[model samples]
Each structure stands twice: as structure tokens, then as C-alpha cells.
Target: MGDRFEKLQDRLRDWTKADLPGEIWHSVDLFDQDDYDILVVPSFSVDQQVGEKIEGFLHYEERLLFSLIRLRNPHTRVIYVTALPLCPIVIDYYLQLLPGIPFSHARERLLPISLYDGSLKPLSKKILERPRLVDKIRRALRPNKAYMVCYNCTELERKLSLELDIPLLAASPDLLHWGSKSGSREIFAECNIPFPDGSFTVTSTEELLEELYELWLRQPDLKRIVVKLNEGFSGEGNALLDLRPILDYAPDKCERVETINALDKQLQNLSCQAEGETWESFSKRIPKLGAIVEAFIEGEVKRSPSVQGYIRPTKEVEILSTHDQILGGADGQVYMGCHFPADAAYRLKLQDLGLKVGEALAARGAMERYSVDFITVQHPETNEWDIQAIEINLRKGGTTHPFMTLKLLTNGNFDYDTGLFLSQQDQEKHYIATDNLQKEQYRGLLPNDLMDIIAEKRLHFDSSSRTGSVFHLMGALSEFGKLGLTSIGNSMEEAEEIYERVEAVLDEETKNYGDRASSLPLNWDKA
Candidate 1:
């Protein structure tokens, strides 16, 4: 890959806003004073969406940052924004997601995003090669001396930099070093951070079975364990170990008297996957692809968790923590949108430990924004709270990045010392919808055309055009499906009303668009 990129740089001339294949929100706040020393640009999607998956990694943000610094202000100094890291733990957590209460028209009503109708993802044969993209980026920047495009590279970043003559910001400088589950465990031990008790870190399949046997010995009653890969992301890289894999070898793992069929039935209840589902529909799409399984703890406290922290440029832990639910999971869940100061009640419990984790990274000399996850549990006997660290994402999270973009356009003074982003003008936010579009469908829309659609306050399809009048989800019901959404409202009632309206609009649009199959994500402004 590195060799490929190096070869390409000699031929390409990167320019500003060279129309790329995938969706990009190359946005800038019209209201920003243009005063900040370093401006971090948002990146392109990690991979270009192929069929069902967006394969490979490329630092789209790095390409943008390099170009921006040279053109925007090369000598001044800047840091390219990094992409958020996802939990490999939940990647492919469940094969089939059980529909929530309103299962009626929910499937029928969804806007074709989830309906698996042998609709093969028409991924480009030309994947977004990072090295090639970097070559294009170098042509755009023409920088005299390279500084750094900040991010934790995972194959994608390395080639992009080597090809472009750009310095890769080793996230070793940021908490990206803490991306390892083991590193997270250590942060917990060294600082007494609260989190799940991980018994072991198994690397190979044998070690995995040995640990499982040991866990059974230590707590023989424990039946299932949650296994995840150290390098996995989103919900694509994980599995829940049942008796089946070992059933063929060690019948003991499956009770001989109860028989393998009985063991299969039991494991079946753990997931929604049916025996008939296709390979694409299977959970843990790529098995034998490395995993990290731990004791599966069952509990009543199902609410999600988050805690935001920042390591300053000076390398200090001086930031407040904010938290939220991982709102969108298999059940129509996307990452997060809602955020609030860590609840007052849990403050004291998480504060010291949160700081300890932040400081640990700072001591390692990586200073930037990062967030951690944990589940707060009440002791079975004492009813006491124990907030445990799930893992640390070494880069900016979904909540932090978009909000900062809003901050640039708002009237608030962002106190970097204190993680509080003061809402400037009664809060106006961009309702960003990062959805995948069949490139063919989006045949004529331009960046401005999409913005124009948004500006019109129309949330349904234009009957004549056969495209999105506004294809957004019913904010209320969105959370039930995998690609969920929640309206962040000042009042819950208003949020409810918004959700209702979003649904009403969808119903009407569905009736209208069903009559005609329109080209999606049409780059209308393109020539």
C-alpha cells in the first residue's frame, strides 16, 4: 500500500474540494471569527461504501487538513480532526434484532434503509485508496514544511501520510494509544476506575478456550461470555460464545445428556438470528477474525454511559466530563446525539477516576480530546453505585465533534480549560443526517442542492421529482430500529410532537415516492 501511494504522488495534483465519490460535509461556520490558531477539519468516511460494508481506512480528514493548512494558512499551524472510534465489543453483537412494540408497519414503513431485498450494495470497484487520496491531497496543499494531520491511523493513515510527504499525527500523542481493551483495563487498575471485571485477555483460539474453561471453574454457573477483537470497530468485530463451537470437539462444553440440540436451542435464545439468514445477515460477519470475549454480566441497569475529557495542548487533564446513552445500537441505534454534564449524583464517583484516566494519557505525552465508557451498577447487596470503565476511544467522539462545529457558528465562548461549551444564541443546531445513498439514486444533487432541500423545511418527497422531500426518521420511533435518532428537545413534549410530524411526513412521502423510483443522492450541481 505504501509503495502504491508513493508511486501515485508523482502524477496527481490535489485541489480544493475535488469532487470525491462518497458523502462529505465539508462545512465551515459562516459565523466563525476565524480567530482560532488550529482549525480541525471534519474527515471523509473511513471507507467508501461498497455493498453492505465500507471497506478499508483512509484519513479523509488528514487529506483535508493538509490542503486547508497550506491554502488556509500553512505557516500558522493546525491539526486535522480525527475520526471517532467505535466499540468492537458490540460489532455484530446480535444477528437479528427483535423489533420493538410497534412492529406493525415499522418494517413496511422504513425508508428502504433496512429492507434487505437482495439489494446488493453497489460499492465502487474503485475503493477509496488512502495513498491515492493522499497523492491528490499533496497536490492540493503544496506545503513548504509539513506539520501534522492529527489522527490515530489504522492502515489508512499510514499510507496516506507516506505518500503525501505529510507527518502522521501518531495518536500516541492523543488517547488513541488507549484504544486497546487491555490498556483500558490497566487504566482501571492503576486509577481504581470502575468498570467490568475482565478476567483475562485471550489472543488465540486455544487461549480463548482455556480462559473459558477457567472462567467456568472459577464460576461454574456462568454460561456465556462476551468476546471481542482488540482491533475491531463499530459492531462488526465481536461474538457471544455459546456451546456450539466446542460442541463438536468437547461435548462436555455442551451437556451430553441434554444433547447438542438442546445446547443449540439455548444459544438461539441469546440472539435473534434465525438458521435461514444469509451470510451477509449473520452477526460477526467475519468469524475467525480475532476477538476479545469476557464474562457476560447480566444486569437490570440498561441505561448507556459516557464521560468526556480533554488533554490540553500543554499536556494536562483540565476538562469536564459529559455523558450520554449509546442511543442507537442494533435496535435502530446509531451512536450518540444527546449530551449533558455528567449527572450530579454520579459526579463524585466518576470524577477522580475520570481524571486519572485522562492524566495517564497525558503522562504518555498525548494531548487531545478523548472519551470513555462505563456501566453504572448497583451492588446486589448494598445498592451502591459502581461505575466501571468499558473502554477508552482515543479520538474525538460523535458528540464532541459535531457540537464543536455548531460552537463555531454560535455565540458561545468555548472554555477549553473547562469542557463547557456555552450555548451562544439560544442554540441553533444542524440536524445532520449521515445516511448511505445508492450513488445512482443521488444522480443530480449538489452540495448546495442538498443544503437547499434542508433550507426549505420540507421533510418529505417532492412528488414530481421522485426524491426526498425530506427523508428523515420519525424521531420517536427511530431509536427502535438499528439506524435510530432522538430529537434533542428542550422539552420532551416538543420532541414528541416533532417525532409525530416526522412520521406524518414520512407516511405521505412514502405514498408519493413509491409511485416513482428516483435517482438517489444525485449530484445535481455537478457537470
Candidate 2:
């Protein structure tokens, strides 16, 4: 079955190469004046166990609602599939954001299909399991003018692509290794990029311990180390091991055999980034999913910055945007949100380094979007920043939708020279976005209730000024009290202010609700 699917995928790839012009396939160019059908399968086809840990993970499908803006072209049709039906109010809200398009006209071109299954399986798998659903999708697409886009391409997505007989606008699943934690380290080495000192990929506890011991030997002064699952996402599969607890076993204090023994016992003390995670359960996954250990770059002042770019079908690498990510967890490793264009100090440097990685991935036949994360530390006295490459995400990530929303809303283009996004009106744009605006107080607020708040407070993005708020994950609001939004402004300060205003408004609106739970601290301030 796998071999047959691969052959079909090969044919689909050949079809895409023969029929589509490279320029037309650019992400931003979805609005190009070409007739095509876009099958938006925003499936987070990751390890189910890891994915289940996230609250309302299925609602993430709404992140790609920005794709609806493609309807502004008048010739493009989008068929969005999800695990469950989307709220009509949520769909209407997105359509209303289309600049000059009429609501009814855009609605006519959009098809939102739901499997009505809320199971904890990947949406792609759900579709593959239902032949009727697969046929419905196939019938909705134009014979040769359609392609599928997904959150991440996995074996499931590839199989779905074959079932639908359409090309997937993502990297081939066979090349997914290049996106893994260990594979990312290898790419950094091949490109001569600076990443933390780490061990090769290990698939068993013994192998992991061996690698950790070698890493300690290389960086004896290292205070901490990060253990990452090769296929982790959003840092959930990461754990921090504080070496201070076992300093007595240091190379200087004890013999190699003694140090190894101490390290083995200390492994149980790993502080996992994922909620409710334990070293025992985490280590158990080592054999199923490979893991790696790297010296944790430490500094008094550090920033988590990331660069997003695209690997064009033509093998051209295009840098899309850069952002300073807002992270929050027990040890500040989880992804929370981001400020666009990163910091001026090193935004350009990020672009240069990101292009290097993109070029390398392109050479390896990687396609579509790819993002690289980095840890930048400031020198207290010299004020110089030291940047270290972290890992590569070969998929549409947290920053993808927000940046795409900005482009689709204002028809902006990212100015690589300045690392700023410029609107069609030539005005500069900035935004702060997050998918973690969750609060127990926000639970039970139906889609209509949220829209009423948006209307009363004028929280919607302003078409005239091209600065305001655009919300996503509306489906998660009623059930999980979680929502996502991108607050755009002419400047960084303005963007932050807008986001703060939204936070304040939501707090005020929900403050009177009974049995109120303490609000989770908004981590935007950390950015």
C-alpha cells in the first residue's frame, strides 16, 4: 500500500510540474488571477499522543481560515475539511474580512466540509477512513486545477493526496527527516551554521544516555541541557535537565564511570516542558520517537526568534517573515505567540541565516514552507548578540497564519531589505499574534457572543487603516475558552497596544461570569 501511494504521489508531482507555473504556486500568489480549486486540509498529522496533550487541538483547523481570503481573486475556490463542522458565525466572520468581495459571492465559492467526527485522530486519517467523504472532496475539486494544502505533510496526508488524486502543496513525506530535531542539527552542520553542541539521534534510553555523556564531556561547564524528541512540535516533547543537581559527578570531581552512573540516576529529574509529562513516560517514547540532547544556551538576556520562508517548486528560496516568539512553560520553552519582523537589531541577520538553511533544504528537494528557530543572547557589556540555530519546522507553524492573515488582509509584501511588511498602500505593518488566549472565564461564549463583542468594541481589523484585530480558533472559544488572533498595526508598539486592548476587553466582558477561575497570565509581555 505504501509503495502504491508513493507511485501515485510521484504521478501527482509530475502533473503539478507539468501544469502549474512556479510563480502561481507562491503562497502569497494564491490570489493570482488563475482559476483553481484549493483543498485546505489543516490536519495536524503529528504523533497522536503528543497532539492530544494540547487543549482543543482539533480547533487548530481554523488557523487556515486566512486561506479564505484567496476568494478575493474571484477565480479561486477553497474547500476546507475539518474533523467537525465549523460554526456558521466563524465562517461568516472570515468572509467579511475580504476587502472588496461581496459576502455572498465569496461564500458561494467556499465549501466547508466536516466529517462530524470529534475523535482524537488526524483529520487526514478521518477523511481516508471515509470513502464517501473522500469522494465528496474529489467531486468538489476541478478535474486538473486543484491541489491540497495541509498544516503538516505526513504519511496520512500523502495517502489522502493519493485518494483524492490531487497534488499536495507540501514537502514530500519521505524528506520529513530533514525537519526532525536531529536532522536539523545535521543540516546546521552541513551549512556551517552555529547550533548548540548536541548528540546524534538516539532511539533508545541507553543510546540517549551515551550521547548525553559525550555531550557533557564536550561542554563540562554546561549548566543545563535540552532533551528533544526528534519529531516534537511546539516544544512539548522537550525536557530540561539541570546539571547542577549532579555537579558532584562532574568530569573534574569524579571518574568517567562514576559520572555516567550519577547521570543515569539524575535522568529521572528531567523537567519536562509539556504539562503533566514525566521522565518515565517521556523516556518510554524514546524508542518510538528518536530523541537528542543539546547544551542549553544560557544567557541573562535571551530571545527566541524565528524565520519563516518558502521552498518554491522552482527550488527558489523566499524569506517570508521573521518574528520574536513569545514562549511560556515551566522553563520558557513552549510556544505562546510572536511579534512580527523580529527585532531590528538581528532581524536581517536572521534572514541571511534562514536563507542558508532554506537553500540547503531546497537542494534536498524540500518544498513549500519551512521555518528555522534560533536562540539569540545579548552580551551584557559589548551589547553584541550571539545567535544559535535551534531547529527547523518544515511545515506551516504558529507564525504562518498570522503572517498570512496580514498579507491577505492588507495585500502586503514582506520587505526583506528592512525585514518589515509593507501594505499595498505602502504603509508599514506589524502584528502580535497568539493561539493561547485561553481563560476559563471565556468558556461558554458562543461564536455569536464573541462576534457581538467584536462588533461592540470594534475589534475587527479596520479596512480603512489596515490596523486592528483578526481572530481565529473561534470554534475553541465556546468549549475550551481558547481563541487565537492577529493584532496588526502600523508599528510594533501600536500592534502590542491593540493586542492588550483586546485582552482587556475580553477580561472585562467575562469578569462578571460566575465561578470564575483565575486568569492565566497573558505571556505577550514576555515578547
Across 1-527, the per-residue lDDT of candidate 1 in tens digits comes to 64554333322212113354321112111222122223233332222221123212221221222122122211233333333221121111110111121332222221111111122211111112334634444554536333233333444444445545554433432233366666677777777766654444555544554555555445545555555555444433334555444444344455543443443344343331222323233334323333354665556654445676666534556444455444443331223344443444564445556678888877775545566776666677776666767777776544453334233323344343443445444332222322221222333333333334334456432223222222211111211221222232223344345445554543443344435654545764573
- The C-alpha stretches of model 1 lying farther than 4 A from their native spots are 1-136, 142-151, 162-170, 173-177, 220-223, 242-290, 327-344, 347-352, 378-384, 413-421, 425-453, 458-504, 515-527
TM-score for all models, in order of appearance: 0.57, 0.94
- Kindly list the per-residue Cα lDDT of model 2 for residues 1-527, writing each as its tens digit: 56765555454446546556654555334354556798999998887778877898889988988878788878889999989899998999888888788999999999989899998898999889999888888998887678888999998998888888887888888889999998999999999999999987899988887888889988889899899998987889999998998998987788878888888898899999888889998998989889999999999999999999887676788998999999999999999999998999999999999999999999988888999999999999999999999999999999999998888878778899999989887899999999999999999998988887898899988888999999999999999999999999999999999999999999999998666543434564684
Task: List, in order, the clash count of every candidate structure.
Answer: 44, 0
lDDT of all predictions: 0.40, 0.88
The per-prediction CA RMSD against the true structure, in angstroms, equals: 13.3, 5.4
Error of 2 at 251 (Å): 2.2
TM-score of structure candidate 2: 0.94
